[model samples]
Target: MAKIVDYGAFADRLKAAPNRWDVLREFHEEWGYAVRPGSDRWDRWTEDEHETYVRALSGEPRDEDGLEGVDLALPIPAALDEWWELPFNSFTHDSQHYETNPVYPPTVRPDPSGYGVAGPLQDDSDLVAPDADRRVCVFMAENQYCNEWGYLAAEAHDPDPRVLVSVDDDRWALQARSVSEFFLQLTVQRLPRTLGWSAEIYDGEEIIDGDEDDLRARITERMPELGFEPWAELQQDTIVYGGPDVLAFVADGELGGIAFAGRTPRAVLDLAERLGVKLTEEDLTEPGEY
Candidate 1:
């Protein structure tokens, strides 16, 4: 039967294996894109450039593939601290051949120093006395079928008392039967469905405990503004939960899609203004550092 796993206990097991890396390399060999070597953007082109690259990838008609015309670049180290503010726990897509898109920050090479392990709480006194009142951030984002794996990770990692979520408007279902179709898939496709989200907290699969419903109720009660409704009756809905922080949201015809950034509305607006980002639903794409 399906059940929640303790993230801490199973953390080490989650590290990528050498064979997994090889598989990713092969994937890149078959479907990789060209990248401009030495470029920090990882030589990845903008969303608009995907079609042009895919057409060439299919050998339908186009330009280069080698270092001169490389399609995608290999994964580079990302910094962990950079993602501290991101609500949902984040992971770099580890498709050996090419690095995953939507690259996360604090890009750094994995070190024995503990890339995924939890550290001490900032306040030692708090550790001596757990506070009943504290909050965490939950980040939410939209994804297609393939990214369900990444979405799963986002739900499992961050562990704070307070949970907040950022959303990527729904854009999962799309047609990509043909090799050329994958290009079109890159474009956001709003589907007429919504997802019921949830999460759990634990040290590992063995010691796992905590109900997503209870967590949701607690967060909503603390915030008192979002007025999130309970979904005990909505059993048929597909529920996603777990990660660094708990995340729960719905994406449907009525909800459209939402991408989460792990920040408060006030922080989001402040950063946007400082960065000259306008406050619109579309601005949800970059929900700020967290």
Candidate 2:
């Protein structure tokens, strides 16, 4: 599929994609995805030596029958249950970790030493007030160990409910209006960090140069579906372009930065060609995975 920035079409895809787990499973090829702890695909990490110390998933296999051992004070929502059944978690590390669904939680109460599938409020990370009354929220994912994102425990029945943020640990704020938006934001934001695919960066350092605005405009001209809004707020000024075969982003750092990720280093060469991005031998790889 051609990479496009058509905002209308993009919005339509986002609206329909939350319930489609099959879209991810279709990327069966490794695509150089960086392996994190507990991943069955750890070929690049530890030189193929899997991390054996990580404990097994606490509950029975995640399925539509309902998270088998994810027993919580509140009922589980159908949308969450559907997401939990993902064949494989594309994430490998803290940048977008959600590998283990609903970890049994900390051994002790109100102190978060253990994590994954749990929230920061339980550990007193100060996301909210220390003395605040605890609401029955079940966190499903975290970033770098503290920032957490989950649906309200009270609204477990909603297919797509409001998403909450604790920042692995926050005072509890609205992350997204619904699970669908949150998932797209998470996947898009983490694409560059976790997906170890072929890429080319136009880093202006005495070489060729292009301002972020021009690059952004050129990209927008090519894929108008994208918006000026940064996909991940944390990565300020970053605009994402996503498709089945490619993922790219333009951001402001110094002058500007743009990245294109493909199946191999040479894979992005095609993108540079199509986008009319100037490149030299230094920007091209030997036609295979880096």
Candidate 3:
């Protein structure tokens, strides 16, 4: 179950710690969260690492109207400062690839090069932008860990407002609201369920070679009637389909496990029903509701 984190108590501890690193270590140890080796010590930034980050920020190509260098105020939430080094997937329930070992926040660079998802601010990027003016912060965590390619964002500049938003292949959807709330939902409400859909089957399930062919035929036959066209290529274990209202996923040949794009979760659920798969309420929920 997701423990209700006392943000007040956490902040107080961070302020009282003689060595912030030591406090972070203790937090991770107690929580069963994994931290990247070097990242655990944020005070030890190499000259090159600092320079690279500075260069990335200074060299950020921007339009005349675009904001320069992340415009948010510094000294972000204390919990985020202490916990950023920990792997997001470590907190996930049934993460396949990122369960035991996961990527660290330092692996991401905060350069505003592409449209958040493609280049400088991808899911793996270390930097998280908190532009309240724009009402979004992209690259908050890995898409795989959250079952949707998304970031911690807010729809409006209201008090205590945030949401999990997924944006893939130009399609986007609000997955959940607030980081703490999302964690509670995932760990408490949806315990034992896999984080997101993927191409590989889990729990000793066997894949039938011809199942992929059948699934593809079904999609090709029904997608048009549902008001979408197959757009991208059918990569190794994933299929990218849909145009304006896009739906993409990494599916096993038999559709045993899958991950769909953010904006089309309901549509994907409908499609799954048509494909003879019945998803539960836990399988997909509306934004802001578990």
- lDDT against the true structure, each candidate: 0.24, 0.47, 0.35
Task: List, residue by residue over 156-221, the lDDT tens digit for candidate 2.
Answer: 557777766553224556666666556545655554334534444665443244565566676767
Candidate 3 residues lying further than 4 Å off, grouped into runs, are 1-69, 72-75, 85-111, 118-132, 141-161, 167-171, 184-290
Tens-place lDDT per residue, model 3, 5-56, is 3222443454465643464345333334453454333332357645554555
Assess every candidate by TM-score. Answer: 0.19, 0.53, 0.31
TM-score, candidate 2, is 0.53
lDDT of 3 at 32: 40
Best by lDDT: 2
Clashes of each: 63, 18, 5
Query: Which residues of candidate 1, in runs, are more than 4 Å off?
Result: 1-39, 45-99, 102-145, 148-200, 203-212, 224-290
Ranking by TM-score: 2, 3, 1
State the displacement of the C-alpha of residue 182, model 1, in Å, after optimal TM-score superposition: 18
